[model samples]
Target: MFISETQIEVRYAETDAMQVVYHGQYVVWFEIGRTRLIKDLGFHYADMEKAGFVSPVTDIQLSYKRPFRYGEMATIRTWIQSHSGIRTTYAYEIVNETGDVCVIGSSVHTVVNKETFRPVKFKKEFPEWHAVYEKEKQGQ
Candidate 1:
């Protein structure tokens, strides 16, 4: 599988009263990782939207392993877990500078038509993008 890694520095404002990263901040980190992954694969989420398709998360689950303090560096590892005709699942792992996993999670999203709200099959609309995903997964 092709995994994309993105690094982020924990900001003080993102922390809780205890000085640890707030739980909700991880969800935003997941998006950063996912967006970077898509862009690294030569596809832009904005382009997809411009094509009249919008991908919205249908489900999300996150597990917090350790607390991250402000000013610490964290890395998000993201990969395509699976992709079907209408939905795609991305898995993620957030690790500290020492490579300790701080969080593990996933998000399930479906592509829908912007106007009609109907599901879209990526293969039909973006064949090359789908093919790249398939090839990378098979190579793994």
Candidate 2:
């Protein structure tokens, strides 16, 4: 399994009135982690878009273990949990500087034709990309 790590600094705007990071910000962080993971695997999501395909999240699960405060640096760790022919599941872990896991989540996504919005099998549409995912996926 290949895990990608991205460091994000909690900003004041991302915090709630209590000065703790807002819950919704973690969803955005998941995207950041996912994008970084793809790039680290030598793939560009832009290329997928240019190919007239888009991967959209169909399911998402998140669990919050701790709260992050503004000015703290958090690490977002991402990896491919599993990948079917048409759907891919990505796992994420957000941790504080001390290595305490603050959040854990996963998102399921499927590729769809941009124009028709019909689901497409990743193996058929992007064989190379699919192959890499298959090889790198965790918990086989």
Candidate 3:
């Protein structure tokens, strides 16, 4: 399986009055991690759009463990967990620099025609990209 890791520093503004990072911020972090994962796989969102496709999250689930405070560093670990038809599921783990998992989550997305908003089968629209992800699934 292919995995991507990205580190981000928590800004003071991300924290609430109690100083713990706001719960909503983790969702944004998941997006950042997902984007990095796609880029690491040699695909860019802009290029995908230019090719007439856009992937949008269809579902999301998150579990928060330890809370992160401002000035801490977070490492987001992301991986493709599954794919079926036109949809793919990506999983993530956000850990503090101290090595504790602060949050675990997953997001499901489907590639669609940017203009029509109709789903596009991966093999039909991007065979090469589909092959890459298939190879990844085969323990590459």
Candidate 4:
């Protein structure tokens, strides 16, 4: 699969009063990872938005395995787990410098017309992008 890795330094502002990363920050990191993954695969989310489509996460599942402190660097590995005519699911892993997984999660999203909010079949709207995704998902 087309996996992309992104590194982020834990900023002080992203931490809680306890100095550990705030739980909500992980979701932001998830977005960073997903964006990077798509870009690395030669597609831009902005381009899709410009074409009158918006992809919104319909579901998310996160599992926290360890804590991350401010000033540390975390690596987020992301990949497209699955893709269909309407929805795409992405998998993610946030790992510490030592390569230990600190968080594991996945997000499911569906493309919709920006104005109408009706679901869009990606394959019909962007056949080339869809073909790339299908090839990537097969690890070709």
- Quantify all predictions' global Cα lDDT against the true fold: 0.91, 0.95, 0.91, 0.93
What RMSD does model 4 have? 0.7
TM-score of each: 0.95, 0.97, 0.95, 0.97
Q: Give the Cα error of residue 38 in candidate 3, in Å.
A: 1.0
Across residues 73-123, which tens digit of lDDT does each residue of candidate 2 receive? 999999999898889999999999999999999999999999999999899
In candidate 3, what are the lDDT values of residues 1-140, reduced to their tens digit?
A: 98899999999999999999999999999999999998999988888899988999999999999999989999999998887758888899999998999999999999999999999898888888788777876667
> Which pairs of residues have clashing backbones in candidate 4?
none
Stretches off by above 4 angstroms in model 3 are none
Q: Write the per-residue lDDT of candidate 4 for residues 28-103, one digit (tens) a residue.
A: 9999999999889888999999999999999999999999998999999999888886888899999999999999
Please tell me which model should have the higher lDDT, number 1 or number 3: 1
Candidate 1 TM-score, C-alpha based: 0.95
